[model samples]
Target: MNAVGVIVEYNPFHNGHAFHLHVAKEQANADIVIAAMSGNFLQRGEPALVSKWKRTEMALKAGADIVFELPYIFATQQADSFASGAVSILEAAGCNSLCFGSESGNIDSFYQTIGFLKNNNELFQQKVKYHIAQGNSYPRATALAFHDLTPNEDMLDLSKPNNILGYQYILSVQKQQASINVFTVSRKNADYHDAYFSSETIASATSIRKALFSENGDIFSVRQYMPETSYNSLLEYKEEYGHFHDWEQYFPLLKFRLVQTTPAQLKNIYEVEEGLENRLISTALESYTFKQFMEKLKTKRYTWTRLQRACVHILTNTTKNEMDRKVEKASYLRLLGMTTKGRVYLNKHKSQLSLPLISKLSLQQNEQIMLDIRASRIYALGTRKNQQRLLEMEFKQPPLILN
Candidate 1:
């Protein structure tokens, strides 16, 4: 009845993800696999290419026994909050371990790095501030600080996407003092940021997204790597909806929110701090697209992704205060999909669970959860078909079986 957990965006659920899921199960010897997945919006501050429900179906078909929605507040955050949110949810779901993919598959190195950061807080903080003042982005500033403290050029490279997130995961586990064992599978095939697909069976989510947006829109091109159910659903959805694309529809709303909020209020949004509010307000007024606005405001002190996430926080109304107040402990275990064995495990552990086990949508009537559900639907304001799909989504049951 033991379970292992994964935190993912599955942004399009490519071959690499399938490999990770398989490895997670094998490594943890888990009877069940649970995933905390991103909702409509992803951590990178962009709308998901596909819907969360569809992604959940893909995960279940690929190997996950259950999937829980990582709330928008946490999903759109930086590495730290993102990891904390996903790990907290998995822990609450009573998972015995967590498995993730990392560029540096060395867990010991990650632990050592975390230990160093913990012991050198004061010096590290001062160095970080000094780097920021020298006009480096937060990631760059962090990298510089690590180099200054550790005197190792290699450690600074940990700012690369997967390594940075991996560090956050280790830090979260350490903070929780949870007994959940941690394991990692080496990332394979394509690099995380590589936009090109390879001939092999495994590919990064970035490459898959690029292919999905390419002129052909051919699911068959990557069919060999994806679960049959996921590929079929994606093709069917694309055919009916002409591809769910872009986050432009929400731009006006975002602008309205930015313009309405005062400098002090903007400063409270995650990633928006230290006079960055003025830049946001000024740039938002002039720029047309979200990407363009972020590009215009990008400074040495803040990376593009960080600025993008801050904009998302503004659009979603997730302030620092609100994020801080969110219960760090897992409060509920939401069941998105599961197998028979997974169901049996849930039934057996239901009484022993620290949090309520959420299955039927009717059971989620709490104000905050309800608001998140509504926001997810609202975020799907892409196309008419998607809009209709969102409006009708409440009636759909969790997809427990592959088609």
Candidate 2:
């Protein structure tokens, strides 16, 4: 049996996601679909709208056969590292292909861009350093350097979010010299950042999340945009938990963490560089809200998104040394949930898996698992429930099995 892989957040499984899952499986002609999903924190440096377990349940109900947890270390980083970690896990799981949604739906362009970067690596590195020295953010600097080197308008589409991540996925596979066939599903209807609901059947995750948390959010209105099964699951979860988390709820804890850390200590945190710690410390002290602190810290050199991720690292005490250790030690595939078919797929491939597959809580608290637990605790802080009970859910929850 063959399986196709996807790296997803599902943040809250909606119609667009179900469409993509349908296309991925059909295009690959695979027997099963495996998803490597983000944990409590997403790539955007905010807590997921729903817990990973809830998201997993949604994915399985929608179409996915299995869900694997993408460790917090990689899930919170920028596109390249995030893709590398996700692809590594999928490859280790013995997937035959990788499928993802893209804005341009052009696979050849991604390959061309990757080839260009590899061939001009030395020059590209020099250009990136020069642009950074000139006070441009890393992402912007890289885009500027690409423009200078290739001057192709089409190639520059790599700057778009989905396309950028798609490029990274292919690049990561090449770096590992793995033979995973790649497929791109053209994105439909809503754009990635679209925050308004335009229809009932198709909308961006952003739009769904915005509506779900808005003051006027009504279940009847929100239900129209999601599959019936997904909508029901979300509705059940909301009724029990009140609502999903918003980033604002985590502000107090983040502020407290920032207040206690000195500049010297903050300097050693992962992704903290070029005196960013000073800015974080000073701004955090002066600003009371997460919004105010982010506004004060945002600049041409440091994007708001980057600053938000930095705050997450500090709140969880994730330092550069620790990040490196975790990255090096990410050798196990942690299972989150699976469908009946997914279980069969895994059992068939068990002997061929390159990494140890973890399906239950362990007695040993390793560095990587510890960081994930810490991230979960921080995410739980955003909820109104008892903190200890929320933490206990991490240990008590078993892999979701969908018949």
Best by TM-score: 2
Q: Write the per-residue lDDT of candidate 1 for residues 1-403, one digit (tens) a residue.
A: 8899999998788778888988999889989898998877888888787777778878887788878888766777778888988888887778999998888877777777776787898999999999988999777888889888864433424767888888888788878887789977778867899888775677777777777667886777777767777788788777766666555666787888889889988888766788989988999899898668767988766777777777777877776766663555545566666767767777788787766776656623664465466556567556556477665664465546433
Off-target runs (Cα >4 Å) in candidate 2 are: 153-156, 325-329, 363-365
Can you give the TM-score per candidate against the true fold? 0.89, 0.95
True-vs-predicted CA distance for residue 108, candidate 2, Å: 0.9
Candidate 1: residue pairs that collide = 136-300, 137-300
Model 1 TM-score, all chains together = 0.89
The lDDT, on a scale of 0 to 1, for candidate 2 is 0.85
- Return the TM-score for candidate 2, rounded to 2 decimals: 0.95
In candidate 2, position 30 carries an lDDT of 93
- Span of ten consecutive residues with least summed lDDT in model 1: 150-159
Return model 2's CA RMSD, one decimal. 1.9
Lowest summed lDDT across 10 adjacent residues in model 2 is found at 322-331
